[model samples]
Target: MMIPRMLRCSVLLFLILAVTSCVHTPPLYVNLSQHNPIIDDYKALTNAGLAQRCCPEFPLKDGWLGGDGDVSVPLDATTTLFLFSDSYVGQQNQTKRNVPGTKIIANTVAIQSCKWEDESEINYFWNRMYTSNPRPVFEPKKHGNKFWVNDAFLLEGKLYVLLEEIGEKENAAPDDVFNFTQVGYTMAKIDNPYDTPLTWNIDYLPLPGFQHPQTGISCLTRHKEYVYFFINNNDRVQQLVRKAVTDFEDMDHGFEYFARDRSWQSGIETADMDTLFTGFRCTTVKYHSAVKKWVMIKDIQFKTNEIKMRCSPELTGPWSEERVVYTIPETTPGNEHYHENNFCYLPRECTQNYNSKSCEMVMTYDVNNFDLSYVINHELIYTPRVITIYLPVEESGGPEE
Candidate 1:
């Protein structure tokens, strides 16, 4: 029963189309919540009152607070601490009482603690808000400080915080030539987060060989026995580099880069590292045990006002394509504050919800814009927002299977 050649070819083409249709999965829908309690509370305190305080007085000006660092460390099941950079406190436009001419209120690393009996009952406490005396967790040397904390990871009951030392002028254009002289990290005891004049153990580590002069370590993640540093290179590509968990503190050795061919190699040469994903900055990757996958939430550099989610089966992986999980109306082009940059950064603590089938992730972004309208008329928009995302369930007996 030999079929005619054209008929056979047509039948094969139809079969292939059917299989492809069945195997192709549609993009996951991101569910933005109608009500974000955190933002609501912020609005109530800052916008609804005659006083008009954008944030609490403890961390930033008149409470006109906003900053970019999203490194979070979970101390226990119910307690978490969030770290901030370029935090301002006191009057929005006031000179530091001590530094005569300097208008910067506070050039320090600020922290906020979130305590919860359960997921639904979380309470946030600023370091200085409710206390008789308030202070920043980590203070910088002076105004226009170049060093700022970027990301952190917990190991052996200690927190390792990565501090990026910038050799460029403050507020330089994104494309400006910024020099990264050295990449250093510091450590603090997990239990001593609130120590005044906090004691920190500092050390410097050589940048990964593949790192470009403009590249910086955006985030850190732990998988199996290694700690992976996600590098944001000048070309807007994300590179994955790793160091054995045991040698993390050693820094002089045991570091390797994921090469283009997907193999681990012991060098930092730009040519040796592989590009795991592109257009990612300020990312957080955590393992989802329930689904046995690594889930990453990050800011898409190429896509303004958009935050994306990616999943992978391995640490250094064939990561899933970026899915737009959330977008900010304020940062969109033509919007009132469109000129200002916005980022949706996921803290490492948010990974607690990763295993849940239905999970809500809270992300933070800067709400400041140089636009006159935003500075004078806008309500306090600098705060964290919550977004709910559901991981896709695997269907049984797929066409490929």
Candidate 2:
């Protein structure tokens, strides 16, 4: 169950980068004027504000020290549920987790009440094997496998969590993040999300044909009657698929693929669709009322200190090329705590905190290195670091993600 939590890269951006191969039409960057915006397009283009957000360190408890995969689901205007993966639970010595007997669990979760407000509180959850041994809250049923969380959304008071079951890859070095492969896509249906996750009534759903393709819970979004899923393939081709909102009970059936002709197709027709990664991309996709387009925030792969964005008029689109919006100052030399191994990752947007009037949105990412030795000394390395981005309001929405 040692999933290194590295598979959650923003594959959506990577796959979206390969759009020309699958799309049949020309650029979908519809005319800006025709799209309709709340403000003049020129004035709306304000510079983004980037800075680190608080806690500087993770609030650790006996079973929750620090972890990665901080994808959040805003349950209400003031409440949010954060999903974490490959958690460092069990123990810590001051800021370091290298204390004796410290253990790393597959996953954990946190509930933030009054989020974005001064009174907010974050509480992490896990199950106890007895008194001392803690296990992941959503433990996988498959033997020798672990559950790593993906994006989740609330529908009709229920929480639907996207998960990928992973198992160790043969002969991988202990520190290798790529030492595991996805077992398949799984759905965790929580009946009472408001209650403590420990008391949650959850059902583990093994998605039908989970092995047909290596689809990570990269992202799950909804529009009108259909909920869309972005599928990732290791070849770099991304496929958009949808199922009716009413078909939640029969999730295994009724899935329709977005075809090159803009029609929804089904069955073997999707067999030929392209993909770019073996795991889900955990990219946060949300509509910015100010910009009037869905925006995805991510840290550039290999270009660690930079944060960038890509947008599309529609999910199945001719996505705009990435634009680097911010550069992390920590990676720059001469900063108080700069390291050659300090790389940024897991960039995700906080949609509830978005202010349409100011056209500003909050975002977070984690900084880490491959060396556990370095991480042990930097207690805050795995905690979520924050930033703010602003978009230029357009005359109308011709195209954006």
Candidate 3:
């Protein structure tokens, strides 16, 4: 959906003013460690050409294979699986358009395998098992319309996915076809997701006490015996809620939300949910062992180009102020190609060097402007951009040389 120009401009101006006025002060976590955080530049995943065999049109003319919903699952020390949400096959123009007669090939969920050759290089390969008509795995139909996977992860050897049900309303405008409703989560038992031509035994589960008109889990993570889910309410604010690990299969009565006082309360409505972060849509949270902290990466709600990072000593705790780790120059709100949107998100399992004193986190994100009109006239900028972030070790000495 295209953001209104007036609103976009206002946000851009506000961010610019905010950045310019900041003093040359140290990072918020400077007290935890004297060494500065090392953040690398954005690296575009170029190995997408390997996936062309499944869908020749991949990396669609101007667009890329998938949009949003990026969650990386580590298969081993060097191999990882990247799962995409609402993935599609075909030219970018045809797949993203809502006009009449446009061909839409919905892949539902797409998988890509990545192998790390070294610290700075990765090779990508497509998994054909996920590229099927209607995508045989985990397809939910509601009132004759099919739902798509929004996000997924492997927990205790089972694949858990959040599904969204969406379709064009009768006689709706061309731009309204993509409107969707959060349909909740589903679980599937799979021996190995990386294996080609895989089979899945899927089960749908209801999110009791948390279901509402425009609310759904944006991202999830497990700490100790609890699974934390970041709930998004369509509005900018995100709430943190958790459920007992033992009751994961018993969805009906396991959820408890974190309240303003930092205490867990039973029932969603009874809990005074605290806002985790503002101006965030797609989000991810992971626990880092090296620093004994929880790290989060998410795109600023309206300002997609800016990816913010935050850290906390505990899962449900006093988080540090957000720091703008990376900004996509191409999507700068007032730039030539200002309409483009970008996001940087990481899965809970993708960190390879957690034991190292310096934490190195690897993740992928999408970069593309969703405006249909912009794509037709200009080349599409839709693709997943990979990046690595290094968090300095917590040492008593001054900044690491």
**Relative to the unseen true structure, what is the C-alpha lDDT of residue 315 in candidate 3, on a scale of 0 to 100?**
69
Q: What is the alpha-carbon lDDT for the whole of candidate 1?
A: 0.45
TM-scores of the models, in the order given: 0.63, 0.77, 0.66
Candidate with maximal lDDT: 2
Instruction: Give the C-alpha lDDT of model 2.
Output: 0.60
lDDT of 1 by residue, 65-148 (tens): 444454555433323345665443434343232322222222244332222121122222233542334344443344333555
lDDT of 3 by residue, 1-401 (tens): 21222311111112221111111211121111221211210111222222121111123322223444455544333333445554433332343443333322332333322222222222222223223323424455555454554555556555566555545456656675235445455443343444432333457775545553445666677666777777776656778888886767777786788888877888675336887666555467766544456777665544456666777887666676776655555567676545544322332224432223223344455555556445333433444554444443343221111
Total backbone collisions for each predicted model: 6, 19, 1
Model 2 C-alpha lDDT per residue in residues 1-401, reported as the tens digit of each score: 11122212222221111000111221122111222221111122222111111111136653467888787776544445788888877642233477765677888888655423233455667777324577888878777899888777776667788887888888998778578977777889886777767778898877765452444346767666777777655424566777776877576688777766667777424565433222224377776544456676643465356677767677666666676766665576776657777776777776655544444456667777767787776677776665555554543431222
Q: Sum up the clashes in candidate 2.
A: 19
Ranking, lDDT, top scorer first: 2, 3, 1
Arrange candidates by TM-score, descending. Answer: 2, 3, 1
